[model samples]
Target: MLFVDFTPPAPCVGDLNNDGVINTADLAQFLGQFGQTVAPGTGADLTGDGVVNTADLALFLGRFGQSC
Candidate 1:
């Protein structure tokens, strides 16, 4: 028997609000958690460092205005 790979598409890094787009609303969502230690695997923690910092901010900016 052969098994096929079943990898799921990764979530959009900058779509913090998970609204199918990366925009001001996601920006707002990110800002709301800025400087805080976000929960593990949370969108606000873009860098996945467990904290929402400038790194995540920069990443968010880079992907802003993108559609999921």
Candidate 2:
């Protein structure tokens, strides 16, 4: 038998609160978790690489003010 390690992607990038929109709340959440490693589905890790750093922040900035 064959097995695959599949991890689902975040529903939306920068939508930390998962309120179906990327707004200030998400921004706050991201900032709070900045420079840390968080699991997928959590808006903190925008890159989905398990780390919340400048790169993720940058990606999130690109999606800022946009709704999912």
Candidate 3:
């Protein structure tokens, strides 16, 4: 017999609201650390344009909290 343990991993993004998924909420958390250089990740890829920058931040904020 083989035994397997199943457990969900911790969220890589911080979306405290837990609205079925993480996106801008997580980005909002990142923005708090803006103007300070830091490593990049999914939340930083706001516009999905293959880079992180002010434009992505603006796009994220512009459409925050609106379900698709």
Candidate 4:
């Protein structure tokens, strides 16, 4: 049998939503998932506070589209 990893990759520190880079797209993505629980291994936890809550979303939005 073959095994495949199902864990979501880490989000780029600047890539708030983990879509790829820090931009409006990321901001939109974060907003879409706002108030939702990010699964384990998902990099939605921008603040690294433990869970992907509104705080993290806020942080992401705050830096939305800002350069690294």
Per-candidate RMSD, Å: 3.0, 6.9, 6.6, 7.7
lDDT of model 2 at residue 16? Answer: 77
Query: Cα lDDT of all candidates, in order?
Result: 0.87, 0.82, 0.55, 0.65
Scanning candidate 2 in windows of ten residues, the lowest lDDT window is 37-46
Question: In model 4, which runs have C-alpha deviations exceeding 4 angstroms?
Answer: 1-11, 14-20, 41-43, 49-51
TM-score (all chains, Cα) for each model: 0.82, 0.73, 0.38, 0.52
- lDDT, model 3: 0.55
Determine which window of 10 residues in candidate 1 has minimal summed lDDT. 38-47
Candidate 4 per-residue C-alpha lDDT over 3-53 given as tens digits, one digit per residue, 9 for 90 to 100: 999988754564754456688776676667666666643556676555777
**Cα shift from native, residue 59, model 3 (Å):** 1.1
3 or 4, which is superior by lDDT? 4
lDDT (10s digit) by residue, model 2, range 1-68: 99996988557878778788888998898899988777864658877788889988898899999986
Highest-TM-score candidate: 1
Decide which is better by lDDT, 2 or 3. 2
- Sort the predicted structures by TM-score, highest score first: 1, 2, 4, 3
Flag the better candidate by TM-score, 2 or 3. Answer: 2
Q: Candidate 2, after superposition: displacement of residue 41 in Å?
A: 6.1
Residue 28 accuracy (lDDT) in model 4: 70
TM-score of candidate 3 to 2 decimals: 0.38
Q: Any idea how many clashes model 3 has?
A: 0
